[model samples]
Target: MSSGFDPLHPRELDLPMAVPLRADGALVDVTSGEAALTMDDGKIFAAPSDPAQLDDWRAQLVSWREGARARHGVPRRYDDPASAWAARCFTVAQVWLWDELFFDFDAQRFTPERFLADARERFGGLDGIVLWHAYPVIGIDDRNQWDFYDVPGLKQAAAALREMGVAVFVDYNPWDTGTRRAGDDATELAATVRRLGADGIFLDTLKKADPEMVAALDAARPGIGLEGESKLATERIADHTLSWAQWFADSEVPGVLRAHWFERRHMQHHIRRWHRDHSEELRSAWLNGVGMMVWEVVFGVWVGWNDRDSATLRRMLPVQRGLHAWLVEGEWTPLAVHEASVFGSTFTHDGSTLLLLANTSDADVTYRPEGVGWQPLHAGDTADLITVPARGIAAAMQVTGTEPAELDAVRTALAAETPARDASFPHRRTRRLAPQIPSRAQLAPADIRAGATVRTVIVPSGEHVLTVRHRARETGMYDGAPYVDEWKPLPPRLHDQRTLERVVRLANPVRVGVAEVSAAEYALFLDAIGEQAASRDPERPASGVTLARAREYAAWVGGRLPSEDEWQLAAVQPGFRRRVPEVWNWTESEHSDGRTRFVMLKGGSAHESTGSDWYVDGGVRGPEFALKFLLPGLGQDASPSIGFRVCWEETT
Candidate 1:
């Protein structure tokens, strides 16, 4: 007895089946003639013709039930509704299915029975299953089904799967299948979904479609798991939108089955080509959006050497487990997107900021976070610093008030001792000069307060060495003399119009190392050097060496490198600064390049003339060239300009 409702109009009354019974209790007349079959609930059974056949049919039903019980380790009695709504995440192979049409039922490779069965057996306790229906060839000629009204088999299959606690979702196509006569109504498909009793639908092929369709679907089911597939503008999706398909078929929504398990070729294609190609455009479109963008990898099928063992689905358990919270429950915001060398992204959630720093450069690229206060945390090292090498991806989460009290203590100590320095330099400045030669001044350490905080040692009273270099002259005996001799003719040593060049070296180099420098400082440094350098002959290069050398000097003076976050925070100061380019500072991060691990150096090098190129903007190197430092509060201070500063970690 097929136990499901017969197909009828919504206004029509239901009818009973007219199946004949056989003497042997079997369904004898099933294949002999056309019979009015009935579908009561959702179960299908044979309608017997002879009395004997009817009896045999009953026996068969009992045997089938027993077999099902033995196979699934369930009681003979079935639960009412047979299905439960449990949340779960799953991946689908829509592309593979579309590519390999009409899966070979007998071959076992194409059938989803085994996969679904295994999922239920393994993770049946979850809340719901997310199915990714990524069929790109829906409207194609050979598979077009615009006029075919009934797909009762599909509905039955869905129901059967649901009985075992699984939900069914079909990938919805906004555009008509390519062959469906140009303008097929999309609403008809929505009607199909309703008819099929589908739990939800994933929206795909939303290139230039009308927003009304999305609105319509939203109106149909406000929280019905609406996910967008492939290059769909997330901003355009409604606030209740479930997920964004990032990468090729990747889903931003967590708790759904991921797609593309064995499709490495496709994975590389998106990572290397599509994402690489349209990153800029996509980023520009998402500028006004919120947190880090989530993208999908591959969903359906498992990995194998060749395509022979498709049955064996490989699991990336570690990544899947680690990302569970973010994918399933975390809120995200898209920060910034970069093209070419680095696949950089920033996401923040619940006061925690996550920076996805991927090095796409042939050579390792180091990224320093600028504009936010952060401390580096390592897996084992006590240093509040982190380092990531080339060909690597670093998942850096900003340390907030949630950090341990021990960490807070260290930060507080550093904050108490470090002086508040303003790294900002305005575009224009009044030049101060001396009328008379200024004598060399060296302040004693005794005159300076050891624990006093100062913006710059030179700005306030401090022990510093004032170096007065000799000036260059084009003629005469006194022309090339030191400024001291040139100002011999003037009475007062200080004058409003005179420009005096002075380099102050701290009597005792203060420990001043930040994860990174501020953008304002970076900009100021660039401008200061530019103006000073430009004042000389065009053919002449500045004599003070490069920014790279300055960094090296800072390192030599006892300060360590700064991470991108530390640098960005320093640049912004009272507030956060956006973009600036100075010397790329080295970070203590180390990462793997398939075979080896190294560190990343943030900011651009002196060799990089422009700050715009993604390649030169951030660079990385191996540990061989990386500089090391004691953990914060270890009493190690090393750079003249590479001083260390402390930041207050916000409580969550």
Candidate 2:
């Protein structure tokens, strides 16, 4: 009478399976649950990894599949090769469109033909693409609305893409489970996949997918690729899953690489999302052996795809093409090389090994395998030491066993280099000059004596455009030595020493503070707001405050944080003192290194050279960018030597 099947003690199968049955009607032998059994679908069915569990989870799965056939009359299992889908998804890209933002009904914009052409041209060579929230036309405005079931031309577009040898995958939401068979969400989804001729579907926000649904979907179209949103395939429902190796900035890679070592080879991992930084683009692909999915704003998105970033990615196509098998299916071994700051991994395929090293610290790092005669391979160059610049990478292939001559060369090169130092200050310790004149730190709202010398610089309003040249070199590598060949601006950062002209339209003149907000001045604002203030040294710049808190202080002083343009304009004005106490200053604009939100910090600090650290986008609000340590009991372990400078719109 009970419908639920117990995983511990699977009941005997009284009836035969509906279809695709084995010749012997081979059922799951519950007695041999401890033994590993290969399923008809080429998936290994075994007991859970934990030793305490008495029942085999895989046997329970076999019993559950049979029960579904008796209850729902549909067979989801098949003898298809599991790696078929992953092999097809070698180079995947993502596509989507917004409502009316980049489209015009009259002009007939964002047509399927146009989108496909642009994607082909932009992505260069893509095997598959995952369509996200892509409706035929921008009919609805709500982003949360799925609107997939009734979208016009959804099937036609999918079929067209499939015709071009590109696999088409549509988004599916499994949480919309319903009770009735007619209204069953899985049934509808299965029908949609068939109707649209879609090759696969991406299940969003699901830790595990329902087996019945996965079965029904397979029954509709055999061997269809099922992709999960999460990096881990907790439930064996998907062929491959989206691996966010670079999500939260550089936080996810190590754990992801470790997980890849244990997971099934057929179950592939693909890096779907990343920050604007292109430095990690190739590094992630080579290190993790995962594919990259680039989302170009073909039509609808807040930010369109940068052509410059695309060109940078295109350069790596040759490497990806050559190492397809090794990069896609090779076994990953996380390496512990000499440098503690440098992270290393090796991908081995058929006795051939490729080493990947990434430098997280802000300094050049040297690494050599213990006993492998691996020459640093970069378009065929001989190097004694494999040096990776700050926030850079180095890769090489194992050519032969370690030779004493090769090892000696590496050792000699490393010995000749200067001893590694902390990345913060490269050359020498900086000294701070005491402020001779009184600053905002020493004054309060009531202490405003007329003619107190509150120096302010005025920036005239107008249409201003300027071209600036910036190199893609690391912070401490301003001289551009060994990395000169590797130095090139990717994305999110400017192209290597490339000149870019930007236009800024200012409607009115604005007055900006001559110096950064002092610790004493920030204390008055904190007290007025009934919050405890940190150190109250009038001469020191405010140190213990977040970007949001800095904005509050700026507001309390009858001004606001300046935009990147505003900050730059104000600092360039005549009579604008670059430094008083010398601290990093926060701006209103925001930039992200993928994990943390950072406001630009500018102005020379006590620990840096006199003219250094002065600019619009100065310091990130992260411990990695801190120039000095803050006083104890500040609630945070380390705070960047940073403060805020306020700016007001001039009405005169």
- Best-fitting candidate, measured by lDDT? 2
Residues 185-220 of candidate 1 have per-residue lDDT tens digits of: 456556655665555555553422355664565455
Off by over 4 Å in 2: 1-79, 87-91, 97-124, 134-153, 175-182, 231-259, 264-274, 278-285, 296-300, 303-318, 328-331, 336-341, 361-377, 383-394, 400-652
lDDT of the candidates, in the order given: 0.29, 0.46
Can you write out model 2's per-residue Cα lDDT over 497-596, one digit (the tens) per residue? 3444558888998788777777787787778767787767777777646655676666556567776567667767777653444555656655321111
lDDT of 2 at 398: 70
The whole-model C-alpha lDDT of candidate 1 against the native structure comes to: 0.29
> C-alpha displacement of 471 in model 2, angstroms?
40
The best candidate by TM-score is 2
The estimated TM-scores of all candidates read 0.29, 0.43
Instruction: Give the worst 10-residue stretch by lDDT in candidate 1.
Output: 260-269
